[model samples]
Target: MPVSPTDPVSPIDPDSTTGPDSTIGTAAAIAAATIAAAAAADDSTGTDALPYAGGNPYADYRHGEFAFTALTDLADRRLGGAVLAANDELFAERENLLLPEPAEFRPHTFGNKGQIMDGWETRRRRGAGTARPHPTAEDHDWALIRLGVPGIVHGVVVDTAHFRGNYPRQIAVEATELPGTPGPEELLAADWEPLVPRSPVRGHAANGFAVASRRRVTHLRLSQYPDGGIARLRVHGEARPDPAWLAALGTFDLAALEYGGAVEDASDRFFSPPANMIMPGRSRSMGDGWENRRRRDEGHDWVRLRLAGRGVVRAVEIDTGYYVGNAAGWAALYGRDEHGAPDDWFELVPRTRLQPDAVHRLLLPGARPVTHVRLDVFPDGGIARLRLHGSLLDD
Candidate 1:
C-alpha cells in the first residue's frame, strides 16, 4: 500500500466497508501514518533517518539524494589527519576546515590579526590593482587537502555554518592521486579531475554534492570563487585499503574503520553514529561513540559489522571509553562465515557484565574465520570501539 502524506488517518472503516475504493483508502492511510510516525520519531531523537530538514533556504536542496551519510569521511583530520596547504589564509586558519570537532562559535576568541574564526577565511581580494606576493596568482582562493585514506569519493559536504555573508558565492572541487609524498608545487601540477562543478552555495548550512568519479584519489583541491570563508569540508567515500599494507600487518583489527570495516546494521542510531564504534582510537567524549536510546522492551540493541577481511578471530577488545554511567550493562558477540546462512551464526563471546568507561579483552576459544560479527548490548547504551584482533586469511 502506498501512503499519501496529506491524509494519514484512514477514512474507510474495515468493518463497515469492503468495497475496492474503501479497502484501498484504509490501507493507504495506515501506511502513511506508520511512515510519518517513524520519521517524526527519528528526527526528534537526532538520529540518522532522513536527510536534515528545516532552516535551509536553498530550494534545490533535495533530501536523501546526496550520499553523505552512507559513506565515511576520508578527509577527516582526526583519522590520521591530512596535509593541508592554501594560497592565502590571512583571516583564519585553513587546517580548521578538516577538524573532527564541530566548528565552534567563540564570541571573544580573537588573535592579533582580527576576530579569530573557527574556519578557513581569507582576506577579501581587491582585484589586480592591489600589490600581492604572487603577482600572477589568480583572482580566487584555493586550498589543497590530502585525504587521510585514499578512496573513491562519492560525495562532499561544504559546511559554511556561521559564514553567512562571508561565504563564497560559488565552490568547485577537484581530486588527484600521486605516488609517495609530493611537494605543493608537484601536487598542483598533477592532473586533477572535477568532483563537483562550480555551483552556487548557501551560507550557514551544509551544502552537499554527489560526486561522479569512480577513480581512487589521495588529494583534493577546493576552489572558491573570489575569496571567502568555509567552515568545514567532508569527503565521504569507501576506503580502498592497500593490499600490501594489510599483508605486512598480518593480524589486525578486522572491525576497524581505517581498514575498510563498516557497520552494516544497528537497532538504533538515536544518540550517536554506530560507525563510530569501529573508528580509529578511543572515543574522546561520550558523544563520540555508538549510543542508542534506553530500551523499555525485552529485546536489546545490537550492531552488525562487516569484517575488513576474512580472518580467524583470536581476541576481541570492547572499549566503553567515556561512556561511564551510560555504558552498556552487558554484551555478547556472534560471528558467521561469508557463505553461511543468517541462522548459522555462532557465538564468539557470551553475554558478560560490562564495566563503564573500561576495556574488556576476551580471548576466543577457537580460531574460526568469520566475515561478519554482531555485538549485542543488553538493554541499550553506548560502545566506543569494537576491536576484533585476528589474522587475515590468505586470498
Candidate 2:
C-alpha cells in the first residue's frame, strides 16, 4: 500500500492545559525523552534518526522565533517543477536533495562506487588538484533551485541529516527573481542577493537560517564550501500573488496557494501540512492534505486561511479524497471580512457530517464578501482540500 500522508504516528490530547508553566514543563520532558530515545536508537542502528511523530523536531528545538515551516519540497513542488542543477554529484544524485521526506540512513550499505548515501554527495576534493566543472569556478559546489512560488522568503532550513563527516562545513544562500522560463545560463547571470551569508553547519541536523528581504524572489542558489553532501532545502515565507494573473482569471479558487492563499494558523500539523489544503488540483494521496492529530477533548481542531484576495464566496468544496478511513467525522465553515481583527464572523456552513473519500459542495446562502475562511474538523482527522470558489472583489 502506498504511504498515506495522513498516517497517524502521534496522537495529541486536546484537553491538556497549555499554560506557560505547563508548556515549558511539557517541552522539557519531551526534549529529554527525545534525546534519550534518539541515543538508544542510534546505538543500535549506527544512525541518528528522530521520529517526526507530533510536531517538527527541527523547528521545535533549532528554529527559535523565526522558525515557521518550510513551504517548498517534493510534496508541494512549489517552483513549477523546478529542476536542481549542481556542480558535482559523484556519490548521490542532486535531485534527491529536494525530496519532501526526511533523509534516511542505512548502515553497512555500499554501492558500486562506495558507501551509498541518500543526499546529494560529491566526490572528495583534495585541495586545488580537483578538476573544476567550470573554468571560472570557485572552490565550492553549488546548486540552483527555482522556487515554486515567487514571493518574499522569511527563512530557510539546510538539513544535513545522515552525513556526519562528509557534510559541508559552511554554506551560503542567494536568490533572484526572473519571469518566464529562463535557461540556467540566464539565471546564473542575473544579479543574486545574499539571503543567508556563509555560515558553519553541523552534520546530521537541520540548520535553519532566517532570511530578511523585502524583494520577491523566484530562484535560489545554494553553495557549499569545498565539497560535501546536503539532505534537503526548505524555503518558508509568504506567497505574493500576481495582480495581472488575478485580473485575467477574474473568478478562481481563492483558497489556492498558487493564488497566494495561506494557512494563517492551525490547531495541528502532525500528520500533514495544513497549507496543502489550499494547493492546486486534487490531492494525489492521503499525505497531500490538512491532517490533524486525533482529539480527545470537547473542542475541535481548526485551520484558518487567508484568501488570495477579498471575494464573495458563491460555492465551497470540501474534498476528503484518499482519506477513506481517517476522514473528519464532521466539519463547520466560518468566514470573516476583517483581516487582522476578526470581530464579525458569519457562519457559511453549519456543523455537518462528512462522508469518507468524497466531495461536498455547498452553495453559500448569503452573498456577503469574505476575506478569510476557517474550517473546523470535529475530533481531528484529514481533509484533502477546502476550496472557496468565488469572484474577486473589484479594486
Question: What is each predicted model's overall lDDT from 0 to 1?
Answer: 0.72, 0.70
Q: Tens digit of lDDT per residue, candidate 2, span 166-269?
A: 88878999998888768789988899999989987766666666665768888899898878888777776667756787889878888887777876556677
Candidate 1: where is the Cα deviation over 4 Å? 1-67, 108-110, 130-138, 340-343
Q: Judged by lDDT, which candidate is best?
A: 1
Which residue pairs in candidate 2 have backbone atoms (N, alpha carbon, C) closer than 3 angstroms, thus clashing? 5-287, 78-148, 79-147, 79-148
Taking all chains together, the TM-score of candidate 1 against the true structure is 0.79
Question: What local lDDT score does residue 138 receive in model 2, on the 0 to 100 scale?
Answer: 52
lDDT tens per residue, model 1, 229-287: 88888777767677688899998888887887866556666777777888788888887
Question: Pairs clashing in candidate 1?
Answer: none
